[model samples]
Target: MLKLLFPILVMLGFAQLTPVSDFFTWDRNLILQGEVWRLITGNFTHTNLAHLIMNAAALMVFCFIFKDILNPKKLWGLLLSISLMTGGLLLLSPIQSYVGLSGVLHGLFIWAAIEDIKQQRSTGWLLLVGVVAKIAWEQYFGASASTISLINANVAIEAHLIGACCGAILQLLYYFYTLSTASDAPK
Candidate 1:
């Protein structure tokens, strides 16, 4: 939906500007110095045109695949929440700086796929398995050489892991919450 894509497109536009990109990268020292906006902004930043294009294309693919399953608000919420959680968790790792939407993408794909399953769409199972396997493989062997070369940075595998975990957990919590709310309604 344009509502969701608008913000992503705006972030992509901002990333194309050198000054904005520099100011928004997730830098630990800068964050320690109180530039906290980087925590959220960094997820929307990118290292190069290749990185931007790759993530943007992935976003479009996800939007097309899950469009019917996820309303724009729900999809945007998953993305923002996962981005924030992943960014915060990265601070606990050895990484001092990070950027790119891949982490949030992983989370969004996961959470949306689960929602698909809740709606009884069989494709959700395929997507869930595929993303879980991808994350698992990344954990075991590191990112693909082609991806590393394309992005020109050591992929933050930890971010991917954190994002996926957060996505699963959030979906679980939401499931429980909805169930409880429904149960509490008057008979």
Candidate 2:
């Protein structure tokens, strides 16, 4: 696990560099101009140290909690899939730019929670409800004042919604795919 996490944390550290973040952040116009990699890179960048720490901590927690199921390949695949989906969906919103991992973290949490439920763990229900409620609160009211102050930017609540939805959709697709594959196996 340390092997898998070391490289990611290192990459996150590098992303904090001003020039790197400026280059990687999801800029609507830049993407339209053919800088498509921003879709993945932006999610790894951050507005500030506080934002990075908050997201890094969450990532660690989710990785720890879902260690049983999260191998490097699975983790990377989930991160990439959610990042791409969320970034693509963000194009439809009014947001011109974004940088942070919170959206991908939400998606990771949702995906792990769904996995927990598949394994018949009751905690999955709790996590799912908790995240949904949090998203709902953010959407209806707005991001917490403290978070906005800490991150030094207005939170993009739409990204949270899109990321969580992407997680659920991807997990469901995986579940069905496995089901069909199992059924096709010789008895």
**Model 1 misplaced regions, further than 4 Å:** none
Question: Which structure among the candidates has the greatest TM-score?
Answer: 2
Write one digit per residue (lDDT tens) for candidate 2, span 1-187. 7876777888999999999998999999999999999998999999999999999888888888888898889888999999999999899999999998888889999988888898999999999999999999999999999999999999989999889998998989998999999999999
Worst 10 residues of 1 by lDDT: 67-76
In TM-score terms, candidate 2 sits at 0.96
User: Which sections of candidate 2 miss by over 4 Å?
Assistant: none
Provide the global lDDT of candidate 1 against the true structure.
0.87
- For candidate 1, list the clashing residue pairs, or say none: none
Q: In candidate 1, residue 43 scores what lDDT?
A: 89
lDDT of each: 0.87, 0.92
